[model samples]
Target chain A: MKDFPGTPGTLTGLMLRVGQFTFAAASIAFVATGVRFQEFTAFCYLIASMGLQVLWSLWLACLDAYAMLAPRDLRNPRLVSLFVVGDWVTATLSLAAACSSAGILVLYDRDLGNCKESVCQRYQFAIAMAFMSWVLIDISSLIMFWLLAAG
Target chain B: MKDFPGTPGTLTGLMLRVGQFTFAAASIAFVATGVRFQEFTAFCYLIASMGLQVLWSLWLACLDAYAMLAPRDLRNPRLVSLFVVGDWVTATLSLAAACSSAGILVLYDRDLGNCKESVCQRYQFAIAMAFMSWVLIDISSLIMFWLLAAG
Candidate 1:
């Protein structure tokens, strides 16, 4: 099998995990700061999704740190399988949540024209952050997927 | 690395690919049948996403079928890496589109309360199918990721 740059337990992998965690956490914080987010189911779902992502990414980051400090490589088949499943699930949920929230934001801005300047700007900022987080997760997910496939 | 089920080019993998294609096609069909879906950006995005999914899944299914018929292991690192990237990209798009469309559906059903029963049901079905497609793709993605890591 060809060696990949971001295999689990490596410094590259640790950095990717940290990126995922930071982006997801920031997305949640931005959305939470927005006023009246709970009024919409999509917004609530986005929070829930980002919360899950934060937890998952944090756990993996800790695991990556441990592996980096330890001697043994952590790219065993069973463990990588577990990581793949977790990453895919979280990635799916995060994308779904982000997209749904954006859809509603567009509706408010374009269709209803009800979003006044301040609140609408918050919504757009939150949604954009969520998308950024999703992009990070997607990249991580793809790397993990590649590692597993090459095995 | 221990052998895992649903490796690319296996029977299980073929079934998964077929499921992805079927659900994505069904989602597009349902949304296309619905009246006024073109008016919403979310719906249009959903259609485009599903269309991409159908093409990707179908291509993979054909590849799987050929591998099954031939004696090749079809677990080549390069090929699997390509599959991983394709699956992740399609999976991300599918989930985003589905979630956004679902958000609009929720807004119409709950907040605005303007959806007629029939149209609402159609919209709900289309979104549900889109979700189904995402689930299948997620499963396939997880399997592919595991295989690569194991290598």
Candidate 2:
């Protein structure tokens, strides 16, 4: 496919693909675990992740659509705005998922009974670090996109 | 002080610092449990993780030093070569550390002579996730850098 939002599209695609695989893996785990413990909470988080990813993906697709459709000489700010929307929403979800995962861990430790794993503790740690990683990427991406837009 | 390779440097710093803390935490268990048990292998992996992290932290520092003192604009392809070197080395070490952590987990499970809570497993899983996250970031960053450069 032709490039859309220039460099920002690459970042978006990378993030979305990562989200896709992560959610898919989590779903597989949910299926394999037998009982539906951790399902509601994890599913909520997974859907959020995938929802943001799909929106971002569609935005890119539309950006592509616009790029292909816009007149060759046109220089519109709307395209850039489309990307920024994706950037911030992804950032918000990235932050939310991380925070909620931590909160869920605390609840689990208190024996809320939504999850059962001999290693449930590890999920909290895993999600927290994953959140940090995503935030780093999201923020840097926002900066880079804004700079490219503004510069 | 400026953000040269911002994502790479920041994530590396976070991983190295956290990984070291994990190493120390695991070390206490590994040592307290004595050297013969396979959690000692976990200890060994911790040390290995620490050693590799130290190298990464140094390399990132060196890149900063080189950028600041080498009298070169970072836009120069030659100057940007640092990212490639750092990315490859980081990818290799990260994968190795991840694999070693997995091995340690198996060994720890098999040799119950060690392991207090599942806490150490959290350390193992978190650091492994950290390393893997950075590797994904590294690969994507290079691809983004290349595409941006190419365009």
Candidate 3:
């Protein structure tokens, strides 16, 4: 199997994990800090999903850092399989949360005309951050899937 | 590699594909028939995503049917990789569409109180069907991923 840049236990993989964690945390912070976010179920779902992403990415980032520092291999088939499953699950949840929140934002901002401009902006920013996190997770999930295939 | 029930060219796989197609079509039918669905971008997105699912599932179902009747091998590594990628992409899109639509439905039905009872019911039904389609796609995507891993 050819080595991929974002393969688990590598510096690149650690960067990707950290990126996911940062974006997810930012997303949560943006939404949670705003007024009335808790009133919307979609926003709450986004917070929950991003919270899960934060934990998953933080855990993996730590693992990747440890593996690099300890000079350990992280390509065991069982471990890779676990990574693949976890990434897929998180990627799916993250995408769903982001998309759902975006849908609600669009409704509130455009069609419904219920949201204040400032609140809408904040929600949009949070959704965008969630999407950024999802993109990183999606990439890492694809990498993990390919690694499992090659293994 | 152990044989899985939903591998791309098998009878069970064909059934799964058919189920996905049927549910996606049902979702579209329910939403499209309802009045004012086009007014909501989330509903439109759902229609578009389910349309893609319908086409993809129908194409693959035909392929699965042909492969089974002809007794052709469909377990090539490259072919499985293609299946994995396709399934993952469609699964993600399907789930996003379903979830986003559901979020909007919740907003309309619960928070905003703008939706009429009958319309809300129809929309709810359509979203449920979309979720059904997503579930089947998720299952097949997982099977394909595992197939790639076992390959």
Candidate 4:
């Protein structure tokens, strides 16, 4: 897959998965750290969405690590198909959650001026992290989608 | 694609593409009809995202129509890759915009009790349409991802 730099089961694959996991976890942490995020449905949804991303990325990262140790090509068509589907699903969910949360920030913090400066900063930070995670997820899905096709 | 009932150059594909276009357009129309949607960046983003979806889906629907009339396989790997990438990108953007807008609705209408009946209903309708569009997009992406892999 031209989109993906490392073949499956290699160190590159492991690193890619790890990057996904780390970003997702960081996004979740930043969002969770915000005070009273549970008060808003969008924030809660963001947490749930990022939580799913974290789990998915962690699972894949572990799989990649195992694959690395085994030194096996994780390019089996069926497995690739599974990976493609998983990546797409997670990518969709993550993007949705991040964007929705960002909307909230824009509405409350920017437009309405409801949030104070300090609180607004937190929201901004969390949403920024979420977007970062989303970028990673999108890249990963693009690669997986291509790999599934080309494999 | 097991999930997709239509072949690329068949009525099913044409129908699917039409479905995508209709839902995306509907989502955009509903959102656009809302009062003061542009006041919020999230709502504006929603409009932009849905607008893109409408264009992509409409374009693909036309291609599908052409393929049906011409009765070509439309299974070229490169073309399939392009379709896969396009579908995933739109899917990601649409889902994000929809979810973010929904988050605003939930926060303002449900949590804060800001919007009253008529306006709240409009927001709800728009968000629902957006969600409907997202479902179609997800299904299409899933099918395209699978097709690219299989092709």
| Model 1 stretches astray by more than 4 angstroms | A1-14, A59-83, A111-114, A141-151, B1-11, B62-78, B147-151
Displacement of residue A113 (Cα, Å) in model 4 is 3.1
Query: Can you tell me which runs of candidate 3 are displaced by over 4 Å?
Result: A1-3, A113-115, B1-3, B77-81, B113-115, B148-150
What lDDT tens digits, residue by residue, belong to model 3 across residues A32-73?
999988878889999999999999999999999999999888
Encode model 3's per-residue lDDT on B1-151: one tens digit a residue: 4577998789999999999999999999999999988888889999999999999999999999999999887888798889888888898888888989999988777767799988889989999999999999988987887777766
lDDT of 1 by residue, A66-145 (tens): 98787567888788878877886787688788888999988788766788889888777777777777777767777766
> Chain A TM-score of each model, in the order shown?
0.93, 0.52, 0.97, 0.92
- State model 4's lDDT: 0.77
Better of 2 and 4 by TM-score: 4
Worst 10 residues of 2 chain A by lDDT: A1-10
Say which candidate scores most in lDDT: 3
Given candidate 1, what's the lDDT at residue B105?
Answer: 94
| Model 2, position B131: C-alpha lDDT score | 49
Model 4 misplacement above 4 A: A1-7, A70-82, A148-151, B1-7, B70-73, B77-82
| Number of the top-ranking candidate, with TM-score as the measure | 3
- Order the candidate numbers by DockQ, best to worst: 4, 3, 1, 2
Of candidates 4 and 3, the better by TM-score: 3
Candidates sorted by lDDT, best first: 3, 1, 4, 2
TM-score of every candidate relative to the true structure? 0.80, 0.38, 0.90, 0.84
Alpha-carbon RMSD of each model: 3.7, 10.9, 2.4, 3.3
- True interface contacts reproduced by each model, as a fraction? 0.74, 0.00, 0.64, 0.87
